[model samples]
Target: MSESFQLRVNDVEYPLSVDQGRNLLGVIRTEIGLTGTKEGCDDCECGACMVLIDGQPVNSCSYLAVQAQGREITTVEGLAEGDELDRLQRNLLEVGGVQCGFCTPGMLMSATALLAEHDDPSDDEIRIGLSGNLCRCTGYARIIEAVRRTADGA
Candidate 1:
């Protein structure tokens, strides 16, 4: 059965009635119209649907909309402030981290979480932070460098 639900996403609260177990990925993309969060390997194994819940990276594909409750959620759309992109986003483009573009959002979310915790993340640390996100394109080298450069204050 469907019921009324509410979730705070990107600093905004959305209230709607949806299927009990609808994934956050679908809610964010379909209900809220923020399509940057991609859906790949919907089983939560690919990390393409990664998003931030209270500053932690999570797979939205597996996270139910109802589970979000009153927690803060951050999606790729929240990474920017008006016209300015976040440092991680600028670095991603400058370092050529985005290729196919499908994995960029999830990768950025993961990197954002890592940078939030460690300002000077090592190469291995960056890898570990982004380990959950899989990208078939760009080989991850540029992506790693992008995160590294941002973390190094470059």
Candidate 2:
């Protein structure tokens, strides 16, 4: 049987009925109609399904949708203010951190959480912050640079 619950995502509340076993990623993409979060390994190996839960990064693929009902979830879509991209988003593009773009959302989410906690992070700190995410297209140098630039207010 499915359970009906509310998920506050991207500052919007969405009431949904889904199977109790449904993952947050599926619910966010299918039920809530937000596709910014991607499903990579689906086993929590890749951070492609990463989203912010109460300002912390989480792998939505392994996290149940029902468990996310009471928390604030921030997806990649939430990072932007309408047509204008967030600073990190613009930096990612400006630094050529995005390649195929499959991993960009998760990367952005993780980096967002990192920057929220650490105003200025070192190279090691940035690496540790984005350790969960795996990117195949960009060697992660540009991605790291983008995060560093964001931290440096550049």
Candidate 3:
């Protein structure tokens, strides 16, 4: 039997009837049509499916959809304001943090969560905060730079 639940994504509340055991990444992408949350490794190691659940980062690919009930979920698609990108998003572009773009969304989400907690995160804090997210491209230097720039208001 399928269970119905309400999920708030990007500030929009959506009613989803999902399988009892469906993972969050599939439900977000297939049911809600939010493809920005990528699924990589599906084992919570790659962080490709990172999303903010109540302002905390989680691997959506491994997170059960039902577990998100009553929680605010933020995806990459939620980080923008109409046509304008979020500060982190703009910084990523300026710093060349995006390569294949698969991990970019996760990295952005993680960075957003980190910045929310620490507006002026040190380099070590930034590195440790983003350690879970793995980017095959860009070698993480540009990604780190982007987060640092955003935190520094650059």
Candidate 4:
């Protein structure tokens, strides 16, 4: 059954009528028309579907859309300003952390949450922060470097 629901995404409000069991990824991509969040493994084994809920990283593929009603939602698309990229996005590109880009969104989201929680995360902390996101192209050294660089304000 479809019910009235509202989601605050990227600081904007979207009112939707969706099934209660619908996943937030679908709702974010389809219903709200934001597609930066990818659906890699529908089973939640992959972090490609990660998003931020109340500043915490979440596997949106397995999270019910209805459960996000009152919380703040942030997607990869929300990471940038009008025509500028987020510092992390710029760092990833500069450090060559993004290749095929499938896992970049989730990585950015997870790293964002991590950085929010830790101003100066260690190498181990960065690895643990990005443990959920998987990148097939880069071996993660550059990604870790990018996060480290961002943390260091370099």
Q: What total of clashing residue pairs does each candidate reach?
A: 0, 0, 0, 0
Estimate the Cα RMSD of every predicted model relative to the unseen true structure. Answer: 0.8, 0.5, 0.8, 0.6
Supply the global lDDT for candidate 2: 0.96
TM-score of 4: 0.98
* Candidate 1: worst-modelled 10 consecutive residues by lDDT: 1-10
> All models: lDDT?
0.93, 0.96, 0.93, 0.94
lDDT of 1 by residue, 1-154 (tens): 8869788999998987889789999999999899999999999898999999999999999988988888999999999999999899999999888988999999999999999999998999999999999999999999999998998887
Pairs clashing within candidate 2: none
Tens digits of per-residue lDDT, candidate 2, 1-154, equal 9999999999899989899999999999998899999999999988999999999999999999999989999999999999999999999999999999999999999999999999999999999999999999988999999999999997
Lowest lDDT 10-residue stretch of candidate 4? 37-46
Clashing pairs in 1: none
Query: For residues 1-154, what per-residue lDDT tens digits would candidate 3 score against the true structure?
Result: 8998899998999998989899999999999999999989999899999999999999999989999989999999999999999889999999888888999999998999999999999889999999999988898999999999988888
- Model 4: pairs clashing at backbone N, Cα or C within 3 Å: none
Steric clash count of candidate 4: 0
Better of 2 and 3 by TM-score: 2
Model 3, residue 100: distance off in Å is: 1.0
